[model samples]
Target: MTKLAINGGTPVRDTYLPYGQQWIEDDDIEEVVKALKSDYLTTGPKIKEFEEKFGKYVGVKYAVAISNGTAALHGASFAAGIKEGDEVITTPITFAASANCILYQGGKPVFADIDSSTYNIDPKDIEEKISSKTKAIVPVDFTGQPVNIDEINAIAKKYNLIVIEDGAHSLGAEYKGKRIGSLVDMTTFSFHPVKHITTGEGGMITTNNKELYEKLKLFRTHGITRDKEILYNKNESSWYYEQLELGYNYRITDIQCALGISQLNKIDKFLRRRREIAEKYNEYLKDIDGIVLPYQEEYIKSSWHLYVIQLELEKFKVGRREIFEALQAENIGVNVHYIPVYYHPYYQKLGYKKGLCPNAEKLYERIITIPLYPKMTDKDVKDVVEALDKVLKYYKR
Candidate 1:
């Protein structure tokens, strides 16, 4: 008989393993403590230090640190001049923030179908979705896999549209030879705990354009400008500042920047461990008839934010939810990456209907995000593999 954990058999793991987690060290703690003891906690020296360090890391000329990833998205959208009547093209298979930023500026979000294999936005679909009102493209690097930047750039150039890359899952990722933050007009990153590097909660926007860089700075701090050149009045006082345009008070604290600096220092180690875990999953689950592993292209290096597996229902007697529950019974904390954004009731209320993007809808039905993090040992990976194997065998058709 095929042993199954849900049937009261011994689980593969005695302890629960979450899908993802932050790996904090003593160094991280020390940095936070140092920041806490310093004279300035918010809008301080560490902010500049962290921004400069991050800019150098990503090979970008400027970086604007913000309160969180969603605020980073909002700042990027504002810098791109995405406003009323403008439409931003993006994929449906991403977090809601990717599209919501457009709405924050009174713009419409045009959903594009994803490439079935890479699970990134298809450039062809992007071109097909462009209308007269389409002003920008917000392509997400879903699961740390780089989108086809070359094609996306060509499309943007042809239509004179801005490109804002959502690099939330891709901090150390590279496409061809260029880093993710360097290739786009503007790229946004998140520092949530589950991400590669944690600043407790923070985000940043990286850009090569000086004008956009300056605009992002103003946008992050309530559109206030103390710069002499752009001020409407000749206020020579150092304390005098003016609100140049409407913006948000989305400034990140120095404490977060200190933690970010510490986390950034160990990014290469974090990336390497994540890749190792992904490679192990590839090796062990390659031949599993009912499982489809993530596709990685040779030209791109993924950050491996999440190890997603697709279930082939034809080879299984049970459904996706059943498998999910079985994995949970085995002490594995599996989760879904996303539901198609337009399928949400809130989105549906805005006149978005089903069949908006069939590929993304299909993906939502089959995708499962399993445990993958730097803290996991080889034994942990093996346990997850064994549990998955048992569950699949028990439910095989």
Candidate 2:
């Protein structure tokens, strides 16, 4: 049998560190246990507490917790009044949900090129893509760096476009010193195990718009209105309710909310540790030839969700696949942040072709996400750096 490249036995430094993962603590479990023992489990007080605390933490007036990130996107899109035949502009260098939410609401997704350095949707390209059918712009905060929201907002004002920021990787990120949630019409965040915080599987949609908040609240449940004022008859008992609009069963359980509350308490620590890891990577890899480290705009503070490094293809003897395989051989777990959304088969069938977003396609050729999570220790960081050094040296022209 061929020996595995990275020694899988004899405590060989466990080489499968992934690009991102949850950092659960004992306290997180304790909180969940407390909730499990409490009176309510699904639609309980803990869920409301989580929503209020999370909304306040992000400086938003309203937050609606949902089943998962995809549901959050769907809720935001629906609340934004995205109707059939409408067009939503967004970048291709993101998870498909960023675009699929548009399709879910019977809206078309228009691909826009991304900024080469930040890997964010380019505001200029977004402006260029606008047409009569365009109703909104969903700018993804890719890899935890907030997009140029000010510029995007300015463009939106010019075109009367609603802004829905896909903030899956940017729960703790800031733009121009302001929290990301408050800067757009609607912002969606994920709580997957790999994200900065985890509530098993959960998501939140934040916005300051009262109408949007009410709409999202109704949409999160089964479109049933429990607000007594919205009822036509005051004599009706608690059993009486109204289905104001078609909605979904995206309500989050109290058990998850309990965990989220616990996780939120440690978010600052999580963000700090992630930044430390990212800074260390930047310091160690800055001098390596042909490697393009992530760039943070002066006005933005990233949550450092993933430390992605781009390779200069012309300077290397081997391609991205070769380097990735070599790292895996060395027991270093690596990943790509995304494949351009348009490259997916479903989108291709929808008339999205390869050349639509050249910059994003170019980014796809060289981007590699290295391991960077809050749980990673100093030695782990050193190990990752050493592995990269070895791989790059081995593949150098």
Clashes of 1: 0
The candidate that wins on lDDT is 1
Where does candidate 1 clash, by residue pair?
none
Which segments of model 1 are wrong by more than 4 Å?
Answer: none
Misplaced by over 4 Å in model 2 are: 1-12, 232-234
Error of 1 at 40 (Å): 0.4
lDDT of 1 by residue, 188-298 (tens): 999999999999899999999999999999999999988999999875798999999898999999999999999999999999999999999999999777999999889
CA lDDT, every prediction? 0.94, 0.91
The pairs that clash in candidate 2 are none
What are the per-model numbers of colliding residue pairs?
0, 0
